[model samples]
Target: MITLNNKKPVNIYDPAYDKLFENLQGNILKGHGRNFTSHIFLRFEENKKDKVKKWIASFANEITSCKKQIKENLAFKRDRTSGDTFIGFYISALGYSFLENFNSSEKETDFFGSMKDANISDIKPSDWESGFREDIHAMILVADDNLMLLREKEISIRKEMNGKCKIVKIENGNVIRNEDGAGVEHFGYADGISQPLFFSDEIQELETKYKDVKINFSSFFPLSQVLVEDPFLKNEEAFGSYLVFRKLEQDVDGFKAKEEKIASIVGRKTDDEKEEIGAIIVGRFEDGTPHILSHEEGIIDNLSNNFLHKNSSNGKCLFLNHIQATNQRDEASREMIMARRGIPYGIFPGEGREVGLLFMSFQSDIKKQFEATQIQANHYKDLIIGQNLPQKMNLDCFGKKGKEINVENFVKLRGGEYFFAPSIPYLKNV
Candidate 1:
């Protein structure tokens, strides 16, 4: 098992790791921290692999490195101003097949088999949106805090693609904020709270902020959790991480309505008490408070990364809750955790508006990490986001038991694809 610690810090810029960080892509070690993002899915035109390679080589200069990202992050911390637009490039298995003379056998087996062919969980490719059903060879992610600047960047990418590549689909994602000014999903719950910490400063900040709490779960992870060798790059420093992108459409009104029903079934009367029902279903209150930590919401000191589900059988937090099903806080569960960097997209509460989360995660092995977690969630019937059919869950809330309520769908799998975020050096040399 991997040991978890808070004493040691992973200094990415240290002499031993500086070269690796220089070759690694941004948003793998740390997020780009941009508010607006656009994912441009592309397919190379027939007989245009040479032009596509040239475009990729030229665009390699625009890719952000982890070293540069960390410097920008520190500068942002010192001053409120953020750096310029951040960009990321990823290629799918089909993209690799299109480019000649590229060796992909060194990659994980799942990379060669696209997400559409993976048959993950209960997701059906036929049900997916048309845009994702088509072949997507590559994706370009452009992000910036300013929407206008983000649009300009997208336009520039489209213009640069010319006839060499066809833009199959474009997904625009904007960060949705809650009343507390933190990022939240369409269901109004704080998201991305329990991400794996890779850097020394990140670990330090988490430890210092939650020093008083007894942290049962550890968020600290080594670089091996996400980094894998890039087959196309000969340098040992060249590494990359597999990326999983899924578009999950949430039914906000349906979920809230079910929450109300669950609240009434659990015998809660007050609004605050009723809210706890939602927390139980989600494994966290809307304000990001872990349900196992405290019954009430907004306990700022309750470290999200410091809770375990060992007592879940006692009914403090339902076994079928989203968090518990996805992560039971066990030694083996730690290996399955992914560095989630998703952002909510589209407007909510408006008629004819389609809103949901643009889920994105980085991992070393898709099958062992993302797919395993999803399969576990399916078995447990995760009430929030599990793609399984409607099923009943034992609602043992507030010391009550023997009550089973059928939980319906709240999230739909719209579309997704798996791609590899390769090293900047690999792209430049391709």
Candidate 2:
């Protein structure tokens, strides 16, 4: 827990791989806040298991002899492992407190507000199943055997300890390809499709280069729905970005049943066609095209996401999809985008609450990206999840997916929180 440059020590709780987890914890203490940098990714290799154990001992020893009579605390743990890859993360109370103060803005440039809008206070880390905690949006993925050993060599071991375990990391497009899952979550409906563009110095330079181009408010101030301006840093201070980690209790079986029922009612045809049902209701196909245009013309294109279609009779895609609903494709103005990094969590046991996905997101503005979806889910029943108004929704299509959805008893929002994910540098200093 030593300070570096007067900065707080970052507690790394990733346990995707057990060995990596123990290694990270030990290294944090031995390195004394020197090794674990913020916003940077780390990878632990299997061959380096011994190296990781030594590092864990170093941190455990420090905690054992801590002079302050350290108070015992409860933390979240996620136990996901591949043969070679395991994924997990953790958050300290100090980090959790930062999440509590995160405020959402009413709109971009609307800096002043009398009171906070949403009440995510009731949301609790306790709501998570067992081994999970709120974490920053970006993740560290490692498959390199050498870097894994290199990580171990960096650890400074002081003593030996137990609680040592090993885990593996799973490799998927989520980490490498920007668009993973063909536009859906692991449970399926394309996600991260619509994200708020950050108003970084680099973005500003781009604005300058394109004179005729207009960076919409949403682009500059992504997640306007939940952008909270820090009073201390009011106008110029770099605004804190909020991350909401939710361990929602989802009824996957129930969800699947409803999806099937909707499909039958919509007169869906092939299995592939059934798969497309989710996309239809969501508006954008997995490949990111409007179903109306994609199926009708039998065409698919990722770039089609950028092609703005008029919201008229000839509109290529329906407006209900996650991408279109919040992106403000043909609206009077553009809305902010919050990058959603959510996954389904829960097990499919006989009765108890199953767990999966450590749902997460990063937003300069939360109100637009996050809140807009909430509004749609509550009002329209998140058409993607087969949740929508019984008959009021305009689900007029050939497929049963969007055509005849009950709209009632669809996706439910259990609980959630607002967190701030700081940069690597910020983590070291904070």
What's each prediction's TM-score? Answer: 0.93, 0.49
Error of 2 at 261 (Å): 2.8
Scored against the true structure, residue 72 in model 2 reaches a CA lDDT of 14
User: Per-residue alpha-carbon lDDT of model 2 for 245-300, expressed as tens digits?
Assistant: 44444455665676576567766657766766666556655555656456531265
Model 1, runs deviating above 4 Å: 1-8, 101-112, 300-302, 311-314, 394-404
Best by lDDT: 1
Please give the range of 10 consecutive residues that has the lowest summed lDDT in model 1.
1-10
By TM-score, how accurate is candidate 2? 0.49
> All models: lDDT?
0.82, 0.37
Stretch of 10 with least lDDT, candidate 2: 65-74
